[model samples]
Target: MTKLQAEVRSNSVAKGKDAMVTEDELDNLAYLKAVVKETLRLHMPAPLLVPHLSMADCDIEGYTIPSGTRTIINAWALARDPSYWENAEEFMPERFMDGGSAAAIDYKGSDFLLLPFGTGRRICPGITFAISTIEIMLANLVYLFNWELPVELAEKGIDMTESFGVTVHRAEKLLLVPIVPQD
Candidate 1:
């Protein structure tokens, strides 16, 4: 969580916002939201969405999907689709904000373009809890501290590499330097 906060702060600064993040500022931080969305997209904790069994035969995208077919949604692939994102291979959060109204798109099941937490009935049961926790924690941390990459690692840019499992995690552990805010 601390690492994530650091990354968010770094991103905010890169976009020319001051290093500090406040509660009121959260609503206007479209770039931060975009960063979060891009992070979730590129590193989906669950690379494969929950499995489901089709009740009846169905054809989707011209494929003959038979009844009782067990299927899994490849959320990882969907998130990286070039049709939905430009420079899909790059970790560019600005793409989400380049268009009008970055916040117009919904992260819920409504938007097919981005589904880090899956979609429809099988969507993550903990969606609300996860989102609320992240927002509150990020707000408080940014409100309280200024962060930097550790001296030893500062020369090396953030390693965005991933190691996949039940949940995705950084290939290498994240180490950061934190400074408490002065009143």
Candidate 2:
């Protein structure tokens, strides 16, 4: 949280303390972007990407997949695959930073390991808008105030469980107390 606050506060000096994060400044907020990527990696909006149909008979590994077979891509599993990610289950935003191991991987679909927004010709059309919205909202939140974890969670810890549906949701509600940061 301090890292995010520092990143936002450092960039917001010229914009004024009251000014919300702007779209133009998103490019310079590297850590903010990494946080968003890490968030998506841990809790994806959709666990399974849109299903695909095989165009022709093909063999993957040892199994033969016939044409017209409906195949679902488990994007959540791919993002959390240990072989492709170090400490795969851990929430480490730095993994997507400039020199991090997964730096080259992204949700834009170019990288298969981290395809939170799906990939190929059928990739999400709202991807650009979605990422920008996430970046701006997250940047502003960290820039505007300080957040405190609930007292109950401090002792019990946060519940990372999820309830599956059209979109994934936290099984337990997280109540964060936002304290306006002082000058």
List TM-score per model, in order: 0.75, 0.92
Best candidate per lDDT, number?
A: 2
- Alpha-carbon local distance difference test for all models: 0.69, 0.88
Candidate 1 C-alpha lDDT tens digits along 1-183: 445455455444343335445445466556556666777778878878778899899988999999999998787887788887677778776667757433455578687767788888877888867765676566656645677888878888789788877677789987777788554
TM for candidate 2 is 0.92
**Which pairs in model 2 have colliding backbones?**
none
TM-score of candidate 1 against the unseen true structure: 0.75
Lowest lDDT block of 10, candidate 2 = 12-21
lDDT of 2 by residue, 1-183 (tens): 999999988877465656887888889999999999999998998989778999999999999999999999998999899998899999899999989988888767888888888898889999889999889888988888899888867777778789988689999888888999778
